[model samples]
Target: MWGGCWPAGPLRRSAFTRRLSVPISAPEALLTVRGLEAGYGKIGVLHGVDLHIAAGEVVTLLGPNGAGKTSLLRALSGLLPWSGGSARFGGLELRGVGPREAAQAGLVHVIEGHRVFTQISVTDNLLLAGYDLPRAERMARVEEALSFFPEIAAKRHEKGGALSGGQQQMLAVAQGLVRRPRLLMLDEPSAGLSPVLVDRVLNVVRELQARGTAVLLVEQLIEKALGAADRVYALAQGRIVLEAATSEADLPRRLERAYFGDDAVSPLEA
Candidate 1:
C-alpha cells in the first residue's frame, strides 16, 4: 500500500530560487499502477494499463492521437472515474478519488490546451491555484512559480487573456506549480507554440524536475517529449504497448514501429 504523497504534515518549506543541478541519485518509483481502467461516459478508453513514476523523474506518455494518452492522465488525476485498478501514489489509492482530493494529496494536473482564467491577472490565477495554502506561503509560491518563467514575470499583473499563446501556456504551468505538487502531470503543453517557445517551456519543465518535482508528461511532439523523459510509455488503442528506459538505444525505432504500424508490437515491449 502506498502512503500517499505527504506524511500528513505541512509541505516542507522550500524555495526554488534558482535552477539546481540535477540530482545524481536515482529515485525509486513513487507512483505505481496496476490493471488501471477508465473511460468516458461508460465507454472504456484505458484498459488495464500499468505505469509508474519515480520521485523527481520525468515520464513521458506518447502515441498517435486517439490512443488514450490523455485518458490515462485524466484517470490518474481523478478527472475521469476509473474502475478495476490500483493506482497508488505515495501510498494512496486513486481510482475512486476526486480531483480536489487528488490535488490536496499533491497530484496536480495541468490539462491540455493551456487552460487558464482568461479574465484574471496572471498573478491572480496563480494565487487561486494556491488557495489551500496559507497567505504568506501562497504568495511565496506564486513568486517562485513566476521565477521559473521570467518571460512572463513582467506580465504577472496583466490579464491572462491578454498574453500571447506561448505565454499563456507558460502561465498554465505556473498555475500548476503554485500548488506545490509532488507529481505534476502535463498534457500537450507544447500545443500552438513556436519551436523556440516549445523549447523554452520544456526547459522550465526540466528545471522543475531538477528541483525534485516528479513530472508525468503527455505530449504529441514525439521527439521533444522523449528527449526529456527518463522513461517513456506508449499508449495505443487504450492500452500500453511499450515501456522502456529513455536510455534504450533502439527506443526511437521501437517507438516508431509500436506507434505507427499495426498490432501490439509485442505486449508491453520491455
Candidate 2:
C-alpha cells in the first residue's frame, strides 16, 4: 500500500536499522525515541521502546491489548511522564513536557473513545482546542479543521450531544487538526464504527499525508492500519518486537510471529 517508497530525505537509522547494526548519520527525524520507559504510579508499562517517524510519513503501531500501545502514545504526547530514556520532537526534547506544551510544539494527540463535550456546540468544541490562540487565528483554524469533515461541519451550530458516535470521532480528529500539528498521534480511532465509517475515518490519514502532516496511528484493524501506513511497528510486552516497511514480503506472517512468539523463522532473521 505504501508503494515501496520512503519520503524524500536522508533517512535516519531507526529501531529496525539498529537491529541490523547499520551505520548511519545522526537522525534528522521529525520524532525520535530511544530506550523510552514509562508507567502508572507503581506499575511499569513500557520498557526501552525505540521508534522514529519521518516528516509526512504515516507509521502504524500494532499490538494486542495490554501491549502498551496506549501507554506509548501517552508517553510521547506528555499525557504520561517517562521514567527513563529520551525523546525529541521537531528538535525539542520531550522530558518534563506536559500535554499542553506537546500540542503547542506541534505534537498533537487525539485520544481514543471519541471524547468530546456533549453539551457545547461543535464550533465551540473546536474553538476550545485553539483557545490559547488569538481570536481571529483560532476561528480561522477551526474553519480549516472543519473542512476535513463536512459531515460535522454541516452541524457546526449543533450541540456535540446531537452528533452520532462516528461524527463525534470526526470532531475529535478535527480538534487535533486545529493545531495543524507536525505529527498527529491517534489512539484506536476505529474502535467503534461501521465499516463505511471506519473507512471514512482512515481516509483522513491519506488526506493528512498529502498535506505533509506525519501521523502515528494506533489501530486494531490490521488490514486498514497497514494500508494507511508506510511503516509498521509491532509492540509486544512493552517492547518493540518487529519493525518493517509495509511493502516488505511476508509482513503479515512476520507480524503474527512477533505477536505470539511463534517459533517459525522470520525474514528479519534470514
Candidate 3:
C-alpha cells in the first residue's frame, strides 16, 4: 500500500514514501487498518475504515468533530471495542491487544484533553511512562524528551494541574515520548492551544519524525495536519471520503469540500 517518492510540495521528498515503494527493502508497515468498524456500545461510529502508515511516516486523520476521529483513535488504542476489521502493527494483529499490549508493541496513544496525572509532579508523569525500561535507558530517554520540552524538566516538581494548558499538552507528548514508541498516535493534539503553542507542538512532531518515529495524528486543525502529515485521510459521516498525498495541488479544494460540504469554506495550508 506504498508507492514511489513524490514531491511533498512542488518537488519535496519523503523518506517514508520512498521506502514504502520498495518491495524488497521496504520496512514492514508500522500500522495498517482494514475495514475497521468501531463505535460506542454498537452505535457504529466508524464504517469500513481503511488506513495504513509505514514506519517513520506521518499520517493525519482530519475531520470535523463527531466525524468519528476520536472514536478511531480510541479503537486503535484498544480503549474502545472494534466491531470489525483488523489493526495490525508490525505484522502482529491487534484483535486481542489491550491498551497495555498496544503500548508494549510500540504504539503509544496520546489523547486530547491532556489527561495527565494531575496529582503527580510533572517529572513523575514522564517517569511513569518509562517505568518498564531499565534505569539507564529510561534516564537517557528522559534526557532526550526533556531536550524537546525543556519547560517540563524545569517544572519537574510542579503538579500537573499547576501547568498552563500548553505546558500540559507538552507534558502529555513528553510522556508518550518516554515510552519510545515506534508508532505515536495523537488525537486532536492542537485542539485548544494558542496559535503559537500549536506551532510549537507541530515543530515537536517534526523533530520526532526526524528521529525516525512514525506519527499518526488525528487533528481538526486542517492546515496544521496537512502541513505536518506526509499524507492525509479525510473522513466524513463515519467513512473515509478522501485520501491524498498532502502535496497534491487540489488538496485544499478537496479538503474544503470534505470538511465543509458544498460551502465555500477554505482550509488555510499552514
**Candidate number achieving the greatest TM-score relative to the actual structure:** 2
Output the better candidate (1/2) by lDDT.
2
Stretches of candidate 2 above 4 Å error? 1-27, 262-270
Question: Model 3, 1-270: lDDT tens per residue?
Answer: 101111122211221122121111225778878899988884889988878888999888876556788888888888989889998899679866799988988899998878899998987787788988888888888877888887777998999999998899999999899888899999877867888988888998899899899998987666777889888887665777677788888877765565444454355632
Q: Give lDDT tens digits, candidate 1, residues 1-270.
A: 111110121211121111112222345778988899888877989888877788999998876567787888888888888867898889788878989989999899999987899999999999999998899999999999999999889998999999999999999999999988899999988889898999998898799888899999987666778788898886666777677887877775665455443332322232
Backbone clash numbers for all candidates listed: 6, 0, 0
lDDT score for candidate 1 against the true structure: 0.79
Q: Of models 2 and 3, which has the larger lDDT?
A: 2
Sort by lDDT, best first.
2, 1, 3
Per-residue lDDT of model 2, residues 38-112, tens digit only: 999888899899899989999999866777899999999888988999999987899779999999999999998
CA lDDT scores, all candidates in order: 0.79, 0.83, 0.78
lDDT of 3 at 37: 90
